[model samples]
Target: MFKKRSLWISILVVTLIIACSTSSSSVPKLRDKHHQPFSSESIWNMPIGADAQYSGAGLGQAKRFSPEINYYIVTQETDPQVPWYFPQNWGVGRCELGGRQLGKIHVRADLIVPDATENKTPNNAAAFLAPDGETLIQLNPLTRCEKGGPVFGHPTPREENIYGMGITGGQGGSGLSSIGGTIRLGELLPSAPPIPHVLKLLVYAHQYLYREPPGYRWPAVRSDAYAYKDDSPLRYGGSNPKLVMGALLAIPPEMREDDLGLQTLPGKKLFHALQDYGGYIVDDTAWDNYAIALESGAETEFELTYGYSFGKNSGPFYEDINQLFRALSIVDNNTPETLGGGGTPRQPLAPPIGN
Candidate 1:
């Protein structure tokens, strides 16, 4: 009788375990209204790849090294009378909008992914205008600078008086004042590869051939890929259809993936940018490479008081401004792969026949 009782208990326990496992796996992963899966990959600041090509020397240059993802282009115009916001619920992280009215591109809901959710805001509308007066581009949620979003909505200067003002101190979105987020290369700073500086001024100097010093460069490039073109005019650089949403960029091989620390004010602001939302590859063209848009109001500001410079009057000198670009690349946001596989394996469709 004791042996029989033990046998029954064991069977009962096994049955319970199997039932629990089945119940958990049976729960479907959340999908947005469009039947699109709520992808963890869309999450902001999630590390996607380890290294990519940044050389602008060649034309029709497809990114030689990067993860495969879908890219989309949506046409939209801004309404000067009404304010717009981006739909936050939908996981759509990348896209381009052209045909701006009133110097701004107002994006509507239908333009967003069908799966996107109605986020913290009602319809999730947002306007994007490249400082170079191109069109609107939204990559990752964290990399954007909405009017009243979590980070700076307008151009904000770093207050030297404040001690702990991380990356949140910058104006927030795409602008000369806006600084790009930093990445960590191995334990040391030198081991990392070169990153882009999406700040407006640096891009302006590069685009206009302002005859500046070595501004921003991808560490692996053999030559200064951003050399000014003596022949090209001040045309819009942020115009490219190849750059799409959900693309994963390769990080520098030597990057210290574990050391994304906030060591400086700009670094802190960048940290906040990624912490809040993620960065996405918005536009990629010969004219402009990696135009990461920040909040707004990148007009003009002083560096001694703010740590960044803008406008003609904002004097840190052209050379000094270039230094800031170099400084921006030296970030160590030891970011991690937030969306990669690390979950329960799915059960086989059928159970094996036992002897």
Candidate 2:
């Protein structure tokens, strides 16, 4: 009787597991909305579109491009530009104005101002996504008046939509949100899905940063320019007109990932992503290295759980990534109309924006 009962219980558990998986499988998933938060039509979410054009101008230049571009360390104590995610409890706070206590706004619940403020730095950046699935809240430099009281920071004056143009939210000289375009948890892991969105890129802006008169592209309203060659001070500065802000850099579709000989799992993942969706040059690294934005707190979680460090010299991981960046070229036609450079899309267009 004991043997029979145990076998029956095991069968019941297995049955429950199968039933759960089958039921949730058909749920209408709007592609990458889980890892990358935004509408399907947002530039970051959509893959390369039809008749794509390439900006061979920058990679064609000497100083701005590098084979050994540095990887961003989100686990670092400062300047990672990560965010603390809060659950769906919309709490109204008095100090939502960075400790003034007069302004009130609905923020992610239980946002202990002190805890958020303690991790401050020059780019003391953090992000909050309201449950509305549309608005993105910026906590550029969160501050508090009390231990766990209402909190606030230098949030943006312009309302930011998660599904809107991912420009101008955080402290970056570029008006991009600290949260958008960042690699979220599990994205680089071995068992993860292929990244369906553009990854964010930061490059050393010394002589490489360039802009046209009036500055930057449409999606990018303005920029912290190194110079505009048309009237630049530094001789030979801004040599690459294609290095303008909002440049969509990617591995040319002709370069197949299989031929790249990438060794690390993460590197292979990155190669496919760059090939399919590519990454956007969203901000300046402020130094002579390139960095990709990863969500805050995600690196620690990945390391502890998977025992892999996202830092430099992680064997073939960095090597694989460097190879991809070295081959990155700009999409000169990635305008609002030709979103991903009008051409046969590298990947299927994300499901059209809907309910």
Candidate 3:
């Protein structure tokens, strides 16, 4: 009888051990490899590419078909010189309406001057003048300025398409540029927008341009129109107008991948802007960097299908832009315990496969 009892006890012990092992194994262990939580300071200070490795000044030109129009990224210093009639300033600074400070604005110039200048004989010029006689410049200022604080001139009713603010996390719709959230600029910074995704794209293109060892050259002018332009003023109109504008920063290829939660087609389109246009802006500063970062954050929601669906690894992306600033200290330690803590407990295991 004792021997029988011993056998039964052995069986029970084995079963208990197995149960414990199985339970432990079933527990989910969340792992995030892309962006291990780091203190905000560390991430913010994280070296963005090699430092002054990429630094310069002056307006970078973009080619255009129109002779009167000119496209370029003007640095902050040079921005003031741009004609008042110009649509907008592409670099940093507060936008003023009628001499009052409106909200902060980012100007992306599409048409610098219109083709109508070609037909002008100096006699019909009076017809083109506004009631005030200011020559109507075709340049359209796609301004992204603040609302409510200091009511700037109402954006033209048709200019309301706020699309392409870059990685605004699904807040905007159908070509609208108004980002849903506001990100403060300056030392005491608020959360960043989803603009960095665009920056990432620009960075990627910059990398591509100088990929080879020094001395290797890629075609400086790819478009045929600009390549064959003659000195004649009329032929100047045929110049590749596209060269006049490039992104202030390009998006990195890796950023477009599913990991960052921006795999959708729209996300891809935004990413293209980043890749193509990154760093085209003349001025490079902390404020611009921060703006880019915040813009990227705002765009995240948009990329995720109005925040309903997200890429599998997008949690970190969200955290990087949204919570990183607040959780800076935690990120330094590079552990969940240091950051926001680990994920919640997993659900209890279901009954065996068949029950």
| Candidate 2 error regions (>4 Å) | 1-28, 31-34, 57-102, 105-125, 131-133, 139-152, 163-168, 211-215, 225-236, 305-308, 352-355
Candidate ranking (lDDT, best to worst): 2, 1, 3
Which ten residues in a row are the worst by lDDT in model 2? Answer: 67-76
Q: What is the C-alpha RMSD of each candidate to the true structure, in Å?
A: 17.8, 9.3, 21.3
> Which residue pairs of candidate 2 clash?
50-342, 50-343, 51-342, 51-343, 52-341, 52-342, 52-343, 168-175, 168-176
Model 3 alpha-carbon drift over 4 Å, by segment: 1-248, 251-267, 276-279, 282-289, 292-355
Pick by TM-score: which candidate is best? 2
- Write down the lDDT of every candidate, Cα atoms only: 0.27, 0.59, 0.24
Task: State TM-scores per candidate.
Answer: 0.26, 0.69, 0.20
Q: Write the per-residue lDDT of candidate 1 for residues 123-215, one digit (tens) a residue.
A: 111223333332323332322333322210122233211111112222211211112222211201222222221122112223322144332
Q: Please report how far candidate 3 places residue 11 from its true position, in Å.
A: 83
Candidate 3 local distance difference test against the native: 0.24
Off by over 4 Å in 1: 1-14, 26-28, 33-250, 257-355
**Candidate 2, RMSD to the unseen true structure:** 9.3
